[model samples]
Target chain A: MSGREEILGRVREALSVPSHAGVKAVSGEGVRDVRKARGFLPDGGATPEARLKKFRKLAAKLKAEVEVLPDLAAAGAFLADLAKTEGWRQIASHRNDLTNSVLTSLKVPILWTDDEPGTADLEQVEAGVTSCEALIAQTGSVFVTGKGCGGRALSVLPPHHVVIATLDQLLPDMLAAFDLLRERYGDNPPSFVSFITGASRTGDIERILVLGAHGPKRLTILIVGN
Target chain B: MTSDTPAHQFQEDSAVSTADFEHRQWMQDALHGYENTRGGTEAMFGDFEQARQTAAAIKWEAIENLDTLLGEFADKLEARGTRVFWAGNGKEAVDYILGVCKEHGAKNIIKSKCMTTEEIHLNPALEAAGMQVVESDLGEYIVQLREEPPFHFVFPAMHLKRDRISQIFEEKLGTEPSSDPEELTMIARRVMRQKYCEADIGISGANFAVADSGMISITENEGNARLTTSLPKVHIAVLGIEKVVPKLEDLSVMLQMLGTAGTGQWLTAYNSMIGGPRQPGEVDGPEEFHVVLLDNHRTKLLADPEQRDALRCIRCGACLNVCPIFKNIGGHNYGTTYQGPIGSVITPHLRGLQSYKHLSFSSSLCGACSETCPVKIDLHHHLMRNRRNAVQEKGGKMERWMFGQFAKVMTHPKRYRGSEGLMRFGAKLWLPFKGRKLDPLKAWTASRDLPAPAPKSFMKQWQAQEREQEEGKS
Candidate 1:
């Protein structure tokens, strides 16, 4: 059966099951009742356009926050310049062509032959740049599939992270992205699919969004257009 | 920080008021966190409808032919020299895992974030058996330190304020007072790193188990997961039966969605595909590898097609983040391993409908969970169905009578019409004695003012309008 059919059938069966008989059962099933009680109602209005409007507004707000680079080469240049300005001697890049070429062009001494940044002399490197498999324009997020980009440390260890992505890789929303992901990776996608919105940010310290927590502080995105 | 503290008391409370209050707080915090994550996630789901359609088709096709595919997958995994154990439920699953730990003499066990383990309450079981289990994932580790269950599925510690974390780190790890997130993560990393290396056995939950090559896939941003599986001498992977897909190609498709949807990452840093024990040419891998295929209520979930969509969940916290109820109460207030919309539906199934019957009432019938689900699980619908089931199958005598009276009053126009006058009379009568508030309506009045009942019902007013129109026309 199709997914919709399968799901619909289950819903029908669930509805056919009995509801509580009286007040005590309702009170006894308090939290659970509230949860289950809040399902779709026939009288409930249709999906609201205001919700979509809010989503659009939020997306626009995020786009404003993230600096969108024009192309891959431009992004590479930006990263190369960032390293140059910082006066860093050593750097790390994943073994992918775009990453390797960018690093080579910059003429920085490369460490950690493997793609993972953790293996590199993290203390020595000022920045790390890797190619992203997907770029989320909605939140200015970039994903680094572990397959091509080495390991988690590449983004985590470096003080600064420069992620490179083509605009074609951008997905509209989480739902749409999953569909594409399934198409490419199937049931067993890569071991890790990092959904990075901005720099490694965490508010766990002081209820403040402290960027550069166990990961990069300065996240530079290079959005390559089609 | 003290045992006698309000925080401690709150945690210990079994009362509904305290639980509701705490649950509300959790939901708010989670919603904010979700807001932060959603921005980046949306960008990754560029053509969301197309992606979902494709994913649903792939998943449906796979499930339809799951039997044959599972057989093929079993053959391949066995060929790779990994022992696969099929457990019927939480008890059996935990037993099989503990058995592995015992066979290997594993004293120290390090684990990545696995909801299945949480569903089974495996840590207490392992510790009871005299084994030490450490959560290696950053969020899991933080929650473990707090001695709290996950508040959010993807970001288990999302409900925790940074101050709480700083306090926990100071108390548990004796860290310096640094509320900086970076500094805090460094502390967690330094602590978990040691656990990862010292671990005798490693356990993880698979995002997907590829039947074609018999490969178990683990996706994560933290290196701890990879370290846990790779550094340990023996590796044990516990996964749900519904996690299986027929081929590597199909597995890839699901991962695409899971990776982006779960955390808004295009892909996580590590996607480790383990094929049994270390092969001839492999440099680093576990000496022994075992796979436990957990069936716990999944076959039953599959039997009922609608509920099976719950199985399609990739443990993404998107729904929880968007859920107003989850934001308010937090994960712990639910008093179950799973939290939020998905948790409400799944908990009743996993633990039995009787124990967690109240969980269904925690929601406001919001369809946010359905909108956010990566696999399109109709969490809202299931929640409603759960309510119906509770009333029909598990309701008490008082509940049945009250609802029956309500149904009768609602169905009868004359009785309903007369009830309006009674409400007004009652309101006026109680107003004098209410002393600025009605005692019976205290809960309702606390958050909102009670509207006075109308003199006439809407149905009655509509009938009057029809009569007036007919007379005017004549």
Candidate 2:
């Protein structure tokens, strides 16, 4: 048997045992019901209007405290302007085409590198920008597959993360979004796919939401219009 | 409060603040573990309620039908040319893991953070068999250095402060004192880098095992888990039977949910899916791979419809991060391998109800854990069920008697009203000595003020209000 066949055959045999009782075949669509099966309502309220209202309310409540940009271009400009204003020393982006494109367009003076971000560079770099695979419109989430986007650390470690996502990347719901992902790539997909809604925020100590506890503090989403 | 005082004996270990080097050192270590785990967990759960439901449902689906999927998984694993071992309990699991280590002549073994191994206490057994086991995960490494059990699942060193870590590293490895987190991380990486290279075997926990390809998936940011499995000659994974999913497509939904719920991320830095070792043209990976499927009270848990959903936990740590009780007291306060809402519910199931009788009541039942769980385990309700089971069925004789008496009085209003005056008489007699040496109220009086009893209870006031309303109408 071929290598793929051999591996898949093992998976089939392992799945064949009487012990694998819960091993029901669920399609990409069934995965949506799995999320609903858990009885999870999206972050805001149930209705789309309510969810939108809640998102807006939450954004407004935290807007003054947590930074929000109008769009991806404005976000990029804000980050660029912030870099200049703050005298940021370095900038980093994943080796993906879109991020490289953004870096080319922005044409900032900061030393831009598209290599794997290490701890030392992450500390020195003032900003990190990357193109995202998917964005959840409801909660302002951004998804990045690890292969092209310099993996998880590039977005997580840097203090300021500016994600450039296209309009078509936006998903109406998380269940629908995940379904789309599975439909595109089967079980053995990429090594990593990250969904980042906002910057690293923690309320662990006395329930006071502290940004940059372990990951990036400021996350600016740049929704690139098609 | 009574139990809290013992925890305060290690008061210096609390990770709430960096106040003084002595106390703050402990707090930083604790906070480090808390932050590490919470960061990862929140990233995975994204939204607590959504993640919790998804996790709970997925887990229930996995376990309720375990008999079929596990068999399929076993078959798939064997077809991949990997060895599969079914361990009925902790002893069997430990025996199989140690046996694998011994068979490989594994003098050194590097491990990622696998709680099931901890549940089975595999390390000591491996050690007893004369093999050195090194935890490659940074947080687990710190806890190993401190000679303490893991406080948090994801971030094991959460209970230790940075200064304490500096002191440990300084003592063990002759490193200098530094409280900076980056410096601490570098220090750990520098040490673990060596351990990873020389180890003969790699051991890890599976986040999800894809039945489609017999692939064991592990999610991590540090890349240590990858190194542990990939670089070693022999790789062994210790997983609960419930970790298996039927296909790779199913694994995607889990990865997305696990990523968000565990650390509030869309995905982790490393979502490694390895099927049995290196193939024909592979450059690197283990030569031999074995997965020890541990039952260890899981079958019993699976039998119960109410408790079976707890198995769906991706171990994302989101529930622990959002749990108010866990935040204040930390994971050790629960006194089990699992901690927080899920821990409070699962510990008794795995260890049985006798030793961990007090673990269930530790939660305030605020449902924060349930609200935050990525798989939606209904943690709060399960916690309540654990408490009810404890009182009605488990041995809480005194508690049951007190509640039974209280219930009797509550149900019979006449008897309750008649006893109210007598209760007041006792209160009046006890008041003069309050806050003094002669005070009967020791614990309550020392911590907070006991409000003076109302002259008339709400029931009496309500009755008077009703009479006034009737008079006015007439």
Candidate 3:
């Protein structure tokens, strides 16, 4: 028999034996609904304004730079100013509805992710700017997918991750985020989905927090709304 | 002092680590920060205890129905062009992984931090086959350089200070020594960047496998796992069969619970899920994806309804951190891929009862591990059960005979009174040896003093008092 069959056979054999001690199992024997998590999980607030407030507080606590601009034009101006201040010569981004319009007039060399840019090219770029699926308010996470966010490497390879998300994209918690993903993608979800909470960090050395361990050091979220 | 015999090694390493007060201080200080953060994070939950119940219920649901979930999980991966392999044991897992590397003609491979891979001891096998393997996690890389297993699960090099890390970096990579944590991290980051770009295959361990969606989820504070999955042309995820969850939505609770328990964070910086290789519309990812489902004695664990709850562990390392025995003897002393309460309970089942049973005794029976368990695993009681099972399987003739002898002596009133003198005489003999190994009760007397047998039997004093009272009344 194949290894799969043999292993499954063993599993079947194992579960077949009755408990000698008559130990009881969980209340529901199979497929416990994850939706039962509503009571105990950390709340993400009921109102959008409340969620945004929580997001801003958490994002700041995690040391990610969050800016709520009035409009996309303002967001672009803010990002362009950030680029000039940080002395960015080259930028990496994908041509999506949000990022394309945001990067249109920004003066910098561009490494478009849609072009299948080389690793060396992405590495040399100052920052990776991609649009996200949603922003998680409770955990202050930015949700991205391989198909939606210029593949996986764009958000990961560059030293600075710049996410330009609209205010309407903010979701209350991970539960809602997962629901949105299911409703949108159905059975065929993106091969890679991530909940990027903050700038990449590690406390490996003497319990000291060090950002940009392998991915972006600075995570800048530009939440644009009129 | 490390020995081929695991039981002896446990003793030798415990003696060595406990004596190093300076090193123990480092471990204590590191865990202190973890305690504060974990306490603060737990308070943020609306009902942390209720959440644990939900977490436990979900895990129970998963493990009890293992065959169906594992089959469904595998089917989901295969449907998306991911070749799924079932490995019965460590050798099979190693063989399949090496075979994949050969098929892909892989030269350099980058690996994320994973205990399952550690359990199988994969790196040595890969190196022996002339493949270069690099550990991408900062803590893991430091331990790899020092040629040591991780000091702790979550913080792999938790026992080391920055000075030691810089020394290793300087010697191994010929980089200048710097005491700054950021500088040390930057050095590793620079080195790993090249490794990620050049590697042909990326191997990872999953925190959970979503059976409903057919995806493997990985959680990490650093993005090294991210690059490992994203950059390489071939990606292989090796995980135990028990990692399955019924659906993707389950991670909504699992991830947060794991984060609060493991490192006391709201969530680790990266919680990524991969269901397939690069999809048709995707621009860049590994062309081929492989998921290796390793049973390696887990099915043996699942079959026992009494101990099956131990399989619900999410590898958060919370139990180890809070365990007093683990705090003292340390991770290396356990001499297993996993350490502390969960390790003690499950190692015997995974390896064997007779040989590894000593681990079950290396606990204070404090139940702190059980109290703190996010999934509410009854860890301390499980340890006691391991001990019971060991004694049952391999009958302890000497211990059984001695207990029988004591039972006989206590039952007869004449013998019980006469044994008082015998016990006092026996104490005199045992007093001289004190804590020496020759003393049969050295385990009790090693660090404490047993008071000299009370000067007079309490029975004689009580009899005298009763006679005096009767004479005065008359």
Candidate 3 lDDT by residue in tens digits, A1-226: 2999999999999989764452333454332556666657888989999999999999998999999999889988998899999999999998888888889889998999899988888889989999999999989999999999999999999999999999999999999999999998999999999999999999999889999999999999999995
Name the lDDT value of residue A3 in candidate 2.
Answer: 26
Q: Each model's TM-score?
A: 0.68, 0.66, 0.96
Isolated chain B TM-score per model? 0.86, 0.85, 0.95
Docking class of 2: incorrect
lDDT of 1 by residue, B1-474 (tens): 233632343334424444566646654654665467655654534355455545555555455555555566667777767787767678888988888889888899999889889888899999999998898777788889889887667777776667788888899888887756767887876676567657899899988877776777776665556566766778888888667665544544466566566665444544556667765433335768888877676656555545656666667667877887666555666766667788888877776776666667767887987877766667888898888887788679997899898999999988987778888899887665453554676645655677676777787799999999999999
Q: What TM value does model 3 have?
A: 0.96
Candidate 3 Cα errors over 4 Å, as ranges: A19-32, B1-4, B430-446, B462-474
Against the true two-chain complex, what DockQ does each candidate achieve?
0.07, 0.06, 0.74
Q: Give per-residue CA lDDT, model 1, range A154-206, as digits (tens).
A: 65556677776665666543334445656776644443345554554444332
Which candidate do you rate higher for DockQ, 2 or 3?
3
Cα lDDT of model 2 by residue, A6-121, tens digit: 33334344334343322222223344345443233334245644544443443343221223345555655756676678677677775556665556546454433343233444
Cα shift from native, residue B290, model 3 (Å): 0.5
User: True contacts preserved, each candidate?
Assistant: 0.06, 0.03, 0.85
Regions more than 4 Å wrong, model 1: A1-226, B1-30, B36-46, B406-474
Share of reference contacts kept by candidate 2: 0.03
* Deviation in Å, model 2, residue A123 alpha carbon: 24
